[model samples]
Target: MTSRFMLIFAAISGFIFVALGAFGAHVLSKTMGAVEMGWIQTGLEYQAFHTLAILGLAVAMQRRISIWFY
Candidate 1:
């Protein structure tokens, strides 16, 4: 059901986040300095966290109480 979809989406998002992180480190690191790298890492971390939060919200949405709140 929706829970399954949410899990799948979360997994995909996690994979993308890892890929982006690796790209930033391996490809961009040479061009950017430490501060720029830190910024890129922070942005990726925030995106990854929000993607998980979306998954959590989807799970919560499946509950009766959550539906009521929404």
Candidate 2:
């Protein structure tokens, strides 16, 4: 994908990351056990990191790193 599209995807993913995090912390915490909550938290962290990686890739694409990135 192009850098612009990658950025848009990253924005969407970031929004999802935040939304799911809030849902897990506020809503799931009450019902889910500590272990389950921990797992969810770990998954969210990974999502957040991956979202950042997407942003980085977008920047790289914008810089014209390679034709293969297009």
The best candidate in terms of TM-score: 2
User: TM-scores for all candidates?
Assistant: 0.68, 0.88
The global C-alpha lDDT for each of the candidates, from Candidate 1 onward, is 0.82, 0.93
**Model 2 lDDT per residue over 1-70, tens place:** 6899999999999999999999998999999999999999999999999999999899888997765654
- Candidate 2 overall Cα lDDT vs. reference? 0.93
Worst 10 residues of 1 by lDDT: 61-70
Candidate 2 local Cα displacement, residue 5, angstroms: 0.7
